[model samples]
Target: MTIRTTHVGSLPRTQDVVDFIFARERGEAYDPDAFDAAMTGATAETVRRQVEAGIDIVSDGETSKISYATYVKDRYTGFAGDSPRNSPADLKMFPSFLERLKNDGGTPTYARPMCVGEVRSKGQGELEKDIANLKAGMEAQGVERGFMNAASPGVISLFLQNDFYPNREAYLAALADAMRDEYRTIVAAGLELQLDCPDLALSRHMLFTDLSDEEFVKVAGMHIEALNHALEGIDPARVRVHICWGNYEGPHVCDIDMDKVFSTLMGAHCRYVLFETSNPRHAHEWTVFRDRKAEIPDDKVLVPGVVDTTTNFVEHPELVAERIARFAGIVGAERVVAGSDCGFGTFAGFGAVDPEIAYAKLGALAEGARIASGRV
Candidate 1:
């Protein structure tokens, strides 16, 4: 495997690109072809810059999708005619949920429906197109071993309300089956699949807010079971699972502790674990790994977040290098890959950091990885 670092998903969006997409959607007279051409050009340039800056695995910067979860929702069926309505809760991670509710106050409630559809039947063509475009871009830049991010079944179930399913378990299973198609598509395309599973932790807030800590763990286990079933039969080596405490700058007062979720996360069928560890709130918890290293298998890789996404200030190269060195010291250098605390743009229309700063942070990440690799 190549020794390098990269983002989990979503780079900050340029103002021009954001304005273009939103304007075009609102009946503004923007040239559709020109907008697409500009997006493609921008994405290609972004990938090339990451590669030139010393990152080994480059994404198309998730330029096409708004947020990892909502982007996939648009292509799938079973969503209610209404869009997601934000609920008032300080426990949620993304700020857009609240912003949406504030702006469109009284929108209908949304839920995920029980999909009776065939697995991998729908979205096959779209998946193929995305992979083909990514492959072409990678080949042009001599970058190999590209990967793409997909929303986990658990996340889909969490975001989309389950109004149509007979019950919650049935609903989750159906979603798992539906998402299995996407997992297979990425694997068949020979691209590494990074399952963005923020819901693994976020669910604690939404589902079991009143439950005891132990009770929440019990509830979360069911979600892990559904995710494992969805991921069943997939080769673990090519699969990576990402989990976080909601990707937003908020008072994570009710966020579940990693100790409560580590066992469930270990049960996931992925060879690599991409986790948030760069932000101030969670960075100190790296000691959790040092204390519980025994729980992690040696064969599995750890991609810890070395860059904090909530801030615009680019991390010092030496600071980035130290974060990587800490993880490498604990779990062999070869098994450690640097990553961001979370996607710079977890939501489509919201971001705290500027796009230029986001790329600069990635540049610093790549530089730091080089420094750490040399030391190791």
Candidate 2:
């Protein structure tokens, strides 16, 4: 069986594309046709790069989004002013490191708007352009499989804080209701839908730092319920949930062990579960799946991150092969797809890995999957 290769959505955005996205986000005087042309061309180039890297399953590189979560501000109504950036608990322990990280040259500052009014879909036409661009890009490149990333309702609540909603449940429900349009639109357009849900584990360190592991699991389950409602009637086979513990290079001491949240996460109605496994903090957690193999339904696929996205180190194909083989040994080779730890570009200007190196890593992932297929 050939193991497929994919990634957790966002890839680096081109400078012009970045300029256009940020301008629109700021409500500045920008040309709508210019934005459309930029996105279309960028999506085409993004698909070509992924195809060149030999990725069997490719994404549009999320060219139209500002960030995985906060991009919702452009699609939905109710967001008004800037929201406070959450301090990840572990990062807070080291003031110097936190400050340095924030000042990193690769990081770009963008607004995180808060919900100030009732959440409603503005019926933004941006999603349509993104869908058309990706579909046309993939078809032109002769790629068979493609997926589009949508911000999870739960993650939106985490980033774009819920100030207007009376409680967390009401906030999530409203967010879910607004996001259902994007989710359905992508799926209806005949592409796989990847729900970016870093809120699953990242929240433990960011938003739910005050809660115990058990308490956080309960909260995560409620979030999953909202996500499920948004994904209603969509075939689980066409859906995947991408979860990570904050895609940053900080010392991840505050991350909840994957074991603590595995069951609750499995509750998501998605066909594929992609999470971090290549990063140092969570690399060894593949053993968690090995230990609880039976908990994963036979229909479920595990796409483990075989390449680390937070660093520039190019993982050797042999190393990537070994990592993929380990997961395939636990599950069947057909049930595993190699992927990156998180997005290479989680935001428009966020560049943890150099753009060239990110594609190289994807090339390694493809080669690794081929090697693992031989062994598994």
TM-score per candidate: 0.87, 0.98
Every candidate's lDDT: 0.74, 0.90
The best candidate by lDDT is 2
Which stretches of model 1 miss by more than 4 angstroms?
Answer: 1-3, 15-39, 83-121
Clash pairs for candidate 1: 111-161, 112-160, 112-161
RMSD per candidate (Å) reads 4.1, 1.1
The residue-by-residue lDDT of candidate 1 on 120-205, one tens digit each, is: 33466656656766787788899877888888877776666566778768877887887888888888888898888877787677
The positional error of residue 352 in candidate 1, measured at the CA in angstroms, is 1.0
Model 1: lowest-lDDT 10 consecutive positions: 105-114
- As a whole number from 0 to 100, the lDDT of residue 7 in candidate 2 is 92
What overall lDDT, based on C-alpha atoms, would model 1 receive against the true structure?
Answer: 0.74
Model 1: residue 289 alpha-carbon error in angstroms: 1.0
- Candidate 2 regions exceeding 4 Å error are none
Cα shift from native, residue 333, model 1 (Å):
0.6
